[model samples]
Target: MTRTESLANRLQEVLLNGRWIANTNYKHQLEDITWEQAIKKVGSLNTIAALTYHVNYYLAGILNVFRGGELEIRDRYSFDLPPICSKEDWDNLVDEFLTNSEAFVLEVSKLPDHKLDMPFVDEKYGTYLRNLEGVIEHCYYHLGQISFLKKLIFA
Candidate 1:
């Protein structure tokens, strides 16, 4: 399959996909939560909304890098969306993050096999793949954290 398709599959299957995984110890699989509930605290007071925003922000930054722009590592899990946070904000940063990630993946998939060998200095982590593959890897990494956080928050 194409590289972009693979990346898209990863995103849909995990990060932005619906339907949580049942029979799993991970609380991330806990489904049917609204934004309010996501940010609600039952015991530990962990907000899925916060995790979602952080993941989306990081993904957006990486995608921007792939599109030949600067990669800016934004905030982590917090109350605000970091760098840009407002009720009047775009209100679609998460969606935009996913969209931009997929677009970046598409561009990378079309690259010639040799192009992946090129070198680009990473802003956050220097000396990396300098390709879309790196971006995909980074997204999945954060996704794992989001999932794990869900477990802790729910547990």
Candidate 2:
């Protein structure tokens, strides 16, 4: 496989499933999470639900970019999660994450390595490689928080 394909695989491992850091992925960490637990804030920390939305918000926005759509998402609304007071709401959010992450993996796999060095939207935003890798790192950072919050809230 090409280097871009390898990066895509790593991205999938981080977002969905496979042995990465801590031997777990974001999806597995979220498994069996109840709405109450997802929304529970440990001290002043953000809720698991909010963090989940924050990660997927960027993934979905980038997915749109892959499909020739605009990257219209703003950082100001990244943490604006919908209410998770109901089971349906939580389930929907998880579903969206799964779908968006999978689609992101596929779209990323289609890119040629050469595209990674090109400007993503504008030169000011940096290259696709930088942004994509940044997102992967971002997920790992928040995945740690999600794991900690899970233990604190569910324990």
Candidate 3:
């Protein structure tokens, strides 16, 4: 497979599903989570819902880059998660996250290998591959947080 295709497959495995990695995908990790459980905070820690939004915030920003826009997100505003006060609200958030993730993966898959090495928007931001891989790494890091928070809330 091409490098871009490989990256896309890896992104898909990490987000939607995974075969080689077993039960570590985002969808698998989020399975059966309830709004009440997601919004619970443990000792000043972030809620699962908040972390979910935080991760998606960057993904959405990267999506903009793929769609010919500059990176526009700031870390200070990353944690401004919306209220997940109802199951419908939480469900919609998940739906939006998943849909955007799918689209991001698709857009990245369309990139030629040469574009991967080019700077993402500007030289200061690093290459497209760097940012893309960074997004995946960022998701897994927060996914772990969400997993731990769920244990605290649901266990």
Output the number of the lDDT-best candidate: 2
Q: Arrange candidates, best lDDT first.
A: 2, 3, 1
lDDT of 1 by residue, 65-147 (tens): 66778855654432355433343333354456556545654555555555444555434543334435554455455556556
lDDT by residue (tens digit), candidate 3, 12-65: 988888746545777877778988888887999988888889888888988887
Pick by TM-score: which candidate is best?
A: 2
Off by over 4 Å in 2: none
Error of 1 at 49 (Å): 1.4
Separately for all candidates shown, the number of backbone clashes (residues 3 or more apart, or on different chains) is 0, 0, 0
Sort the candidates on TM-score, descending order: 2, 3, 1
lDDT of each: 0.50, 0.91, 0.84
Q: Estimate each model's TM-score.
A: 0.55, 0.97, 0.94
Identify the superior model by lDDT, candidate 2 or candidate 3.
2
Measured by TM-score, how close is model 3 to the native structure? Answer: 0.94
Instruction: Report the C-alpha lDDT of model 2 over 1-155, residue by residue, as the tens digit.
Output: 98689888988899888775668888898878998899988999999999999999999999999999998999999998877879899999999999999999999999999999999999999999999889989989999899899889877
